[model samples]
Target: MSLSFASSPFSVVCSEVSFAWPDGTTVLDGLDAAFGTGRTGLIGVNGSGKSTLLALIAGELSPASGTVGVAGEIGYLPQNLPLGTARTVSDLLGISATRSALHAIERGEATEENFTAVGEDWDVEERARAELDRLGLDGLGLDRTVATLSGGEAVMVGLAAQLLARPDVLLLDEPTNNLDLDARRRLYEAVSSWPGVLIVVSHDRELLDLVDEIADLREGGVRSFGGNLSAYEELLAVEREAAERAVRVAGSDMRRQKRELEEAHVKLARRVRYGDKMYEQKREPKVIMQERKRQAQVSAGKHRLMHEDRLSDARERLSEAEEAVRADAEIRVRLPATEVPAGRTVLTVNGLPAQQPASLEELIVRGPERIALTGPNGSGKTTFLRSLLGEGPEGLQVKIGVEGVRYLPQRLDVLDDRLSVVDNVRAFAPSASVNTVRAGLARFLFRGRRAEQPAGTLSGGERFRAVLAALMLAEPAPQLLMLDEPTNNLDMASARRLSEALEAYQGALIVVSHDVPFLRTIGITRWLHLDRDTGLTEIEPM
Candidate 1:
């Protein structure tokens, strides 16, 4: 597959770009890639430098070597929105000055500076509002502070700001990270209808399915596939099949070459034996016999060397073919210890929040029910989980019946940063020996030395595995597992692995997330919606 799109007038190009962290960790080295005027989905495993490449293209970070050339203006929305507590929606939209100037002109204070600030954006407020509405943020007024908005609202507002800029190139990093189902749908619509160069770094499959191309970054380079993610996956499936076949063929060839080399050695030995017999029989003069023996040895050496070279070439080809097969390890662990009986009362809670439905005032969970807690940002979904775990605010009253409930918060703050992965797991599974903890962690993909790496030094995906290992491998085994937005920072493969791990968890689960697809994958048996307007209520799965 090609590593770049077809060049165009408005293409963005990186020529031999190299970037490294302050710690001298190399990300992109001598990477040459181009993105033309179309929607491109940039995907890679965690730590493959997709976000770093986006930053370089957006000019948020400078390349240590080489240059980035863009033919038009660029608007970038990073993975995290750095919204200040005091910043307002207008400030986030990047139209604070224009809105203020327009208001000043409306009040008959049309100063020259105000006119310059407004410029041709006299309808900036209307446009901003339109962009907000397009992204399902219309209800959030422009005057409201960003700190009061939910996490999804802030992300949508940031994206709205970028859209309002009307730049030629739009760059979005994990744009659907915290967005709910409706918000994601809106964002997907926007992505599908985008007219200019759109480069989005996301693990959301639905969002990636709308792209014009897939740019897979691995080993410090990008490989461009001609279609969306689904098509790209299909192509990968075919390639892997072909690669596996090639490996089998190469293995056979290698074995055949080895056998041929052995046969040639045997044949050469037989010729030597025959020559020895001839010499012993005095079939030729002594000098002529010696010369003939030397000639025979030289010919035998040439034959052996040719066979050896063939065997070596076959081995090399086999090695190369083996390299073509991908080996992305997955989390596959059994959790029979977490199982709860059908008649068991895993959890029971009393006293719902104010204005909540009276029917939900006293809730009970029996056996191994999987409940999906979903709501818009700031709808108290996380609060509800915390309150159920008896970690909420002082004024709220909550009662829990479960004793061994484990909560995996959205931030994944369960691990000590200074501790090693094995140590972190052992912290929870105290009764487990170091070797036992290491054995458990290997199931979570932190095998051997990886389990010794400090939590602070781990990458996003690695940190998640460490946290999961610590939680699931705890002593006594949790019968009720609660997770809040667990897949927010995960890549697609990691998210799938999380689902796989959760599938093996035989317990009552309460997961607070906006990821409906992921919720379905883990076999959520019940769905609950917590909303400021509707309180907490059960609903059908989407």
Candidate 2:
């Protein structure tokens, strides 16, 4: 099933690749693609097998059929780094053994085992720290535990570990998921300077813009574009325009063919009637008239088949044309019940975290004001949200005036995996009937059987939507909605859909995110920054 595609010096290739989940859900089928040396941005909608393909290439997953070939050793960083709180920076960098062996050698206990572990890399620690510093993680020391690092810091450390290996191939899945503005800049520089074969799966537009080319995986195939994300988008826009026009033309042709078929039927009927009349009128010999009628019927049958075939062909063309036009739907839901009055007090935080950085002591949020919480990695933005919700540490006083306040964490663990999407939402909105819940889920694009699917079987974007449905459809409706890193791991279309869904919400919002572009799209009215040194402070929108 392998098909050769035109490529230049491909460093990675998938030949006749086919893969399916254990549940018999096919992801990729006979997918053939090749990635040339240099940075390639692998772009796709959620659940299009982009991550699965990376896994196959990185040797983390083996294909059920076909083969994946790589030019050399690989360094892979998955979308969600499997991190433990007790793991130290040295452990994360994968140099703990080497560092330990080097220390032992320095202590004059230079055994053969220690030398074997150390190998020829005596500067492993220095190189590891250099990579960390390059990614703007200098403040995080080697002995610091993962528990002390933020989500973004952990990601940076994982990347640092990969770069330290200097593998011939590098694979990064959503590398910029939790990185702040400055950290993202540092990553962009690293990506720009990468010389070897590099492939990244990310929804970050800025990061994609730095790639040498774009590889779009869709419909079980890979399409290579010669330029970056902007160029690919522009080209795609043009192609879609042409495809839409083709659809219109095909539609017209199909309609015309259908009309011609109807007209041919009418003409055949008229001919049959005329032949019967001629036979009845005795215009010729009886035998001759009968023979003429038989010939007329045969001719009519042929004519009918010809017109039918034409109509069918035209319909097939129309279908093919329509398939080329993408209709990525947006989430369109209205929640008037979540609206709040202008003078209503939503929340009042009487105190802050009892840590150093005594910057702000009190805060108040009123009405449906949308606030953006931004900060550097490890600056306690997420912790601040938890403290305000009374879910985390002690000595942090907070008073919530709103009765209906909901929080959507970055992990999206609110839903019960075993339950259907409808049931999950019903759990939050217990009073709402099944029919009523279904009618509401339709607005989120979970129509019919999709609403009945278990939460575990959903794709990344679908799970996000399902979680949002649960939060918004909760009993009494959430008057204050808090989301932490809501856009992490979300495809571009999904992110846009999130904004579209939020357009109908009339509730107060507190969002902790590092994505400034996303914050702008969601209409943040106030911008706040949290720092360990300065505590919490208000800043103007960029």
Candidate 3:
């Protein structure tokens, strides 16, 4: 029998499903849940089983036990994307003769003769073009390679491809991670209008607030709360309080039972001795002996029950308290810095163009300042960064003062994949020995064997830390730090920690990010918005 959720109220139903990785790490245990047609937000800390849960729901992985039933077709946007570099935005949109051929095949219109004779006809090309146009990729040529596109453009292309599949459910993981403000807004609007069930995993607060329900995954289970992000947060607070109360009650009961059990044992011992002394002194021993035997049986039964109750209560209290504590703790993060003198001029730019072939006449950045580079996606944010780093046009006037500048590129292109963590750090700081490099990496949390591990095997957050470690170890330590989309793959805790470190740093900073809360926390004193239409960069107070 075929299983589909197309006509069902619940798009996904999972009953007592359990899953574990090959390495013996249990991800989900006896999980039961159902998702209806609405926007659902999945929230969890790093390695808290959020991604694994999503994969199971999307049918990418089968449950190790129980049943997972899908009621409809699903469109999944995985965290690790394998995009074809040679495919263009238009090509990714399926605007080609091949798309038409596929459509014809689906409609049973492509006969053997037609397939052989008119395979590359304009009808197919026109249909593909129309679809691409609907997705806002109208003028882009079909042959344009995807590699030339910006991060936001790449994401949009991927989203468009998934939307074209027209599935009844959509699963997206960190869809807006690298997008700028404008692109994020566009993507959000698109997802909001989607008719089917939407399950999104993201750290973006704005995106979470748009969803109808929030699913918090922790402690090997999932809990669902209705309403938007704020409402869910309120519900979480209430649940935490309730759990705390339960824990306290259990603890008190366990302590009381333990004391009673101890007291009962002492009383029973004293009674036995008193009864023995009375039996020795009395002539009517039969009645007294029978009473003593009955009394000893009652005491033994009472002690056994008390011991069992105490163990149960203690176990319950510990479990409840642990869950409550985990939920209540705030995100953890750390950032380190080196002392440096404030320089006069950090950067200067003249006639810099936005992404749409428009130009900004002049821009200037000074030292010991924090500037928030704000712009919509495809407004030349990353392009401007490249120009500042001298990778773009030669004619464009860009200059930096004598001060050292450390740049964290948006794409993490500076990392060496083949090198170990220690070697990568040493490469950046040639004067530093292996021990010094390892020590710096350790400060960033790469300890023990992890420091010797190859950079290729590290997670996204670890790689970012490795890069930061290398930057900090530089002899003169950069006086100005430029970071582009630094929080893309970071968990909530790591993002907060990095923010704290940046806030404590003495050097000048230029940051490009779409995370408003992060920007606010990191102390952005000035803001610059790049207008795509006017091709100009304007400064505004934060």
Candidate 4:
């Protein structure tokens, strides 16, 4: 049956929406949501159907048994963009056809087909160019090929296409995943100034902070919370505190009920003994004794039943209290073996040659210094990391003070997909027994059968944890860990868990990430920005 939230003043609506993957993993089940004017930030754990719901609203996917309603034209930008190299900027902007028709007419070939194509969109190119300029693609030509654009630029272009369309409703899924600081700011500006119904699905704290409201998709439904990310977090904290208090109170009640039940049993046994003694003493007449015994049995049954029912109710209450409490897991227990001495040089970088206009030079990392590498896209962040680690098949020349260096690239392709997570870690640490690997995996939230599952079958968060376990549990023990965009595809929960795991890393760290809030949480001792002219230089926190 079709459904609509009566209080919703939204342009986009989903009514009793249900969807499932080909593998039979149910995502949205009879979900109802509405997005009105202004910015709505859709936040949820990974695989909670946020993307699918957006897709359904965009008409990319059909609901199995429900209706999705959009008031006007819709625009959707998915997490993974279409990266076709053959397409030009005009084509990507979705105005290539109209622009061609207009150009043909300009050349005096005024065909009926051209006029039909142009229709009422004579100013489409101008509008597209204006949107591009607004989104920080000022000098980028319309004729430029899509293949030449960086990841950030591509995202901006995609967004510009949507703006050019001027759709009444817009959907963006993980729009800022691979974006750098500059591109993110541009996108944030666009979001802030949006005039129509816009729904953005992202885990970026900064981006979410700009939304007018937060729509949390959890456990197959939408929960609307007024205000931004910080506000939602504040409200959640208060609710959780209250829930935790309830749990404590319920536990006490449960213990009291249990004690009372035991006391009732003891009192009943004592009464029974007294009654039996009286009967054995033959103090009462035969008829009276029989009547008394019968009454005692009935009273005992009633008392036992009453106590049992009270205990059962207490247990049910305790279970409900526990369920109300959040159980977000934490990563733990990095060995002291991974620790780097304060005075000992863990890494000495003489110079890093970049393909850009500038070059990176000298640094002496002598302790557990947490350094954050930040830059705009295509500024040689990944190139510099590969140079330092001597990765790639070419094996670039590099020097290091320690042999314990480990690099976690953005793609996380370090695992053997065919092997189980346990085997992957075991491959890294040959000397460690199966039991040791299992124990380490447990710390990363991979327990029992999960550890035994093939790496390819794991979800995004699970795969991240597995890769992390292997890196930390390696043979030499990474004293100098280098991570490149570690939080790229992770949801908030996974990202939080990752931060918790990194909290225990005693080794020196040099991670490349655009997540400013996350960098702050990892206790960054240094911040370096890659510039086209200045190269890699130390900078104060943003």
State the lDDT of candidate 2 residue by residue for 222-247, as single tens digits. 99998999999999999999999999
> How does model 3 fare in lDDT?
0.73
Candidate 3 residue lDDT tens string, 1-542: 13576666787887888987554556689988778889999887654667777788888888899788876688888765566786665566655545546567668887875475446543655655564555555675656787777676677767876766678889998899777666677778887888888999888888888999888877777788888788987876787888778888877777887777778777777777876777787856788787876787687677767776776778787776866656423333333354444557667887565545434567766656888887766667787777788887676798887356788877676878787788888887898787777767666777777676677655455567777777777666787788888887676767887888888877678899878789999888778776557565556654
Per-model TM against the reference: 0.87, 0.91, 0.72, 0.84
Tens digits of lDDT, candidate 4, 354-440: 535544467677788899989887667777787787653253445577767888876577999899889999999999999988998
List residue ranges in candidate 4 displaced over 4 A: 1-8, 100-111, 329-337, 341-360, 363-367, 389-397, 411-477
> Where's the lowest-lDDT run of ten residues in candidate 3?
327-336
Give the whole-model CA lDDT for all candidates, comma-separated. Answer: 0.83, 0.86, 0.73, 0.81
Better of 2 and 4 by TM-score: 2
List of clashing residue pairs for candidate 3: 4-71, 5-71, 5-72, 87-146, 333-497, 334-497
Which candidate achieves the best TM-score against the true structure?
A: 2
- CA shift of 309, model 1, Å: 1.1
Q: Give residue 407's lDDT in candidate 1 (0 to 100).
A: 84
Candidate 2 displacement at residue 515 in angstroms? 1.9
The order of the candidates by TM-score, greatest first, is 2, 1, 4, 3
Please give the lDDT score at residue 97 for candidate 4.
91
Which ranges in model 1 have alpha carbons more than 4 Å from their true place? Answer: 1-10, 101-111, 281-283, 329-337, 341-344, 353-359, 393-396, 400-404, 411-478
Which residue runs does candidate 3 get wrong by more than 4 Å? 1-9, 13-34, 52-69, 95-138, 244-319, 327-332, 348-364, 396-404, 413-476, 531-536
Of 1 and 2, the candidate ahead on TM-score is 2
